[model samples]
Target: MTNWLPSLENGTGPLYIRIADEAESAIKSGTLPHGTKLPPQRDLAYDVGVTIGTISRAYALLRERGLVTGEVGRGTYVQGNSDGRVPARDPVTINYGGTRAMVPPPGKLRFDTTAAIDVGQAETVGRIMAEIASAYPGEISSYTRTLSSDWLEAGRQWLSSGNWKPEADQVLPQLGVHAGINAVVAAVSGAGDRIVCEHLTYSQVSRSANLMGRQIALVDSDQNGILPEDFERVCAREHPKAAFIMSSGQNPTLVTLPLSRRKEIVDIARKYNVWLIEDYLYGGMIDDRIPLLAELAPDRTFLLNGLSKSVAAGVRGGWVACPPHMSQRVRVTQKMVSGGLPFLLAELSARLVLSGAAGEIRSKVLTEIGEREALVRQLFAGKEFRSHPRLPFFWLKLPEPWLSGTFKQAVLDADVLIDDEDEFKPARSARVYHHVRVGFSEGRERAISTEGLKTIRRILDQSPLGTSAIV
Candidate 1:
């Protein structure tokens, strides 16, 4: 059942439609039986000569046809159960971070997200929330009209680097880094404007841009970061209005864009008049030693940082430090797009940073991340991998015969969830790095993380040969 593949022989309209047609026919003919786990997209893509994106599009078509359920983060399956029970979904308007796991299903080991190591911030957060509600009942009940100076101070402090610190007036507190990023996109670019991004990057930026009717223009990159020449080529060709870069501890790749490359990119952007969105979610947490992109090119950079990566994920605390004279515009855009920030969330986040409670929790979270990273080092010692000292995840290049999606599926079958390279792909299957990101922080329990790593190690040692792992 794990080796199930749709026959792409002869009949076709669009390739994705053809694959979906095959899947639908198979489903109706009972050839693809209920509960049969399909082959991973990358695996089938290689088998039938297609990009992983093509396979993904086909799977999406199947899902649209109500033939499959689940997603990239959660393993996909045909929509039927052996026990005769239908899955209950809330069917709400939720922006599912398909690459990052939200609350994982029971019994699945979560190795997919780097959304903060929970070091018990709930007690502090809850206490602060209660105090705010009691002290200002009227304020708590009303729409937030003010951006407190305290919020700006906290944002500036957290976003400040070695040689660069923004004035308090330049900072605008946002709902979180993702929201902050989108706000910047909204501010600088219009519908149909091109947004340049690294070929392999945090997909949320590109995804958000696409949702806003902006086109994604992917630039080629190396192990270090985006290649300057390619970026320039993209800038000249695509004529992008904005560009998003992680700069440090970049999502799945864990590469820190060097200062030289930063300067080159800034020059290119300047020449092209492309606004820069510097998402520093993990950058500040990993190392504040390096000078930020905003420091290098404050004229064009919109720096974003938040509490989600360091202190607590549920807090929804984030900020945007815009270029001079641009904070108010981005702030207004954030309000327009995000329906304005919740008063309680804004106040609590500001209090957490100003009160030093967020720092305290951040330290504990960092310590936990270091410990988990150490565990990753010990277990994946001999593997072909790339990771930062403080990053919660590592990029693993698979061996011969093991495609990224195939290994990801094998690992999921063993109850562990990690991101296939496809999850972070900037474009389509035109480029396949044959890598997967394995995160330890989301596993929660150290023992669970240990077991998950062991399972991953076992699968890595055993070539799939088109069959799933026995575990």
Candidate 2:
């Protein structure tokens, strides 16, 4: 009976909560049927390697929820068949041409790949709104209005403080990174122009480039990130109009280009006269955040950043700081796409930034990062995986025996869902070396996710040596 329960070590969250969640799952799944007796607390605790007091607390939680009942000396039993009040499990309906399946609601140990923003960020947004409405109303009442110059100045100051050093006129606010990328790509790289990028890059950027009808040539990269020599070689051959690079905390791979390597890439871009678009999505989280490539070559770089990564996604707010010469191009494109940034949200976000609450939010964010990274380190202690302390995800390069697809399927079978390497490939004949990208942004209390990790580890342990293809 205890074997059905997952091991909770190497995961974030407390022991009793995990046990209670597992017990609730058992009851809902009909494994612990109505009136079926639960194992004695002491016995179950010993089996699962938790204190008996923890087991008692877990059973008490179930009893409080009316899922279980206990009789003194006789033991506890399932109360009823989940009382029918439980919400129906409507699997997340994703219509991806009907080929892919719906994602299941995360269980205890599910490895998440999707970005998750919780109510904390949402509440911050709400507070921002209230501040805007109380302080400056009538502007957001459904009429088209340009953003206030004051808030724009604040944004400009914000960038200057960070050393990006752009004038208020040079800073252009927009909806989000996608819009920012789309506008920049369209303005600099016309239709049919070529853009060069890392072989494995952000899928969103790739999609955005495709939408603009520009061809993207993916250059092979090394472990340190896009190789400087390869980047220079590609620039010489492809003659791309722009190079889209995530200079800090790249997704999927969880690798940040070191300063020396960054300089090499920036120098290559400068030499080739290719526009550099730096996506600073994970900008605020890093310590000693490097100066944007825009600073390195102010004449040829465009910086895109937004609240999507640091704050809530629905903030629908982003700002672009382009080189002074490119200001008119960016402004013209901005007028075509929603005119200027929304004033209410922009003012509110700026308020949050000015009040120093944003710094506090970031501190809390760091605390969460510490918790998640600790869990990742413990879980993948001896496993072949790559991570950074502030990264929201980890890049796990699977062993030789496990193909990327097989590892994905095996882990999915165990109820964990992760992103495969294929999605990031610019072009591919199937996927090469097997890799699974796992996100830790879902917060603690993810025992089901941890369970999925354990299951994958178990599968890999049994897999034949050298079964997977090497890079």
Candidate 3:
């Protein structure tokens, strides 16, 4: 390895990222090769005039990017090139039924593994929560005067990040996404109202509609997401009150609608005068180039964005961005059925999000996600797995002999749980891609879990289908 010291002209941002960036550039330039040993954190800190904490954090960044690996006794070694692309680790084949959680128990893991990782903004969350906890109890507990403008301004600023600016008068804060969905449904539709849905819409949306006694009109989807013409036809025939569409990185499908498709959907909604309930939960993680459905169809659209996807799902914070005409009624519904979100949670989340930690966490998450995808692709070498570049998960199509149920069972025996496609749909033989959603949300360790992937491969190879393991 080349003798190099990364110097920060200004101690701005995190010192560790600057170090990682320099090391990454060096690796890309061939100054460091595969299998080169990196200096110890203390040594690097001494060399670069940074704190040991900074060096440690820098190494963590490298680990998340799949550029290096650390063994218990052995020091860290370069795993691959600086760009973070690396071959999967050697498969440690096992007899199966022995997958263990990659994350260490509470005392060992640096980050929380038990809770669903907010992925992005975790560090920021820690800081904000710390600040909140140290404050006087009255700050968080005592009743505070309520007003709509503050929440509306917050929503407007958030929407502007995606080049959207819904009128402040149209925005309202709900307890959470579920509450917003329930309130919106209650406000828009009565019993027997029909709502158009994507064929692979989120299960919660379906359940919520059912609870409201509304009919769901399922529309077909092609590669780009829900088909435009099918949506138009469904609207024409059903004249649905509102279409609950996810135009951003959709949950199960993990598909993001391109600008052209968004235009098509918007035009159709406009022509039919149909209300649109846009679920933009997967908003902050993916590409921000494409504007949201609300931007295109603001006159008749109600947007739902919550902490559930981008932030801590359990923390329960979400806001409703409505069109001007619906703001009053939406606020009424929000108050009558469910009132404002807890000020403590809302304010904490807002502080974290607005402080730019949310965006930082998002970038970090995407970086980790890329590393996890590399491992997944390496493990499923010969299988026909598919994914979008920025998506959190992949769609794995099963082989002929591996019936979805049987394969799910096989993996379960291997101590790995996988979702069955049929459970996401009703018609068992409808031939809807018999697939499983493999998410990288399990964090870095699970993404690169040697034992877990080997078990996954064994399950794939032993299926009744005539398939052989690669390598």
Cα-based lDDT for every prediction: 0.80, 0.66, 0.65
Clash total of candidate 1: 0
Best model number under lDDT: 1
Q: Give lDDT tens digits, candidate 2, residues 1-471.
A: 223454575434656657787777877877776777788776787788875545655665566456776765577777764454333333222111111234554463445543433426666667778878887667776653555676566566445525456777777776777788778888897888888878777766766677567888777677777888988888999899998888777767766788888789888988898998887766545544677676777778887766665555566567778887787788688667556556676776677667766556656666666666677788778888887776667888887655554455445545666666755655432326577787766543555445655665666665522222100
lDDT of 3 at 254: 70
**Pairs with backbone N, CA or C atoms under 3 Å apart (clashes), candidate 1:** none
Alpha-carbon lDDT of model 1: 0.80
TM-score attained by model 3: 0.68
The digit string of per-residue lDDT tens for model 3 on 206-311 reads 5566656787777888767988999999989998888887786675667778889888999999998888888876655564667878877778888887665545
**Per-residue lDDT tens digits of candidate 1, residues 394-462?**
899998767776677678767888888868865554566789999888745788778999889888988
What candidate 3 gets wrong by more than 4 Å, as runs, is 1-123, 133-136, 142-145, 148-150, 336-339, 426-431, 443-450, 465-471
Ranking by lDDT: 1, 2, 3
lDDT at 224, model 2: 70
The better-scoring model by TM-score among 1 and 3 is 1
Off by over 4 Å in 1: 1-101, 466-471
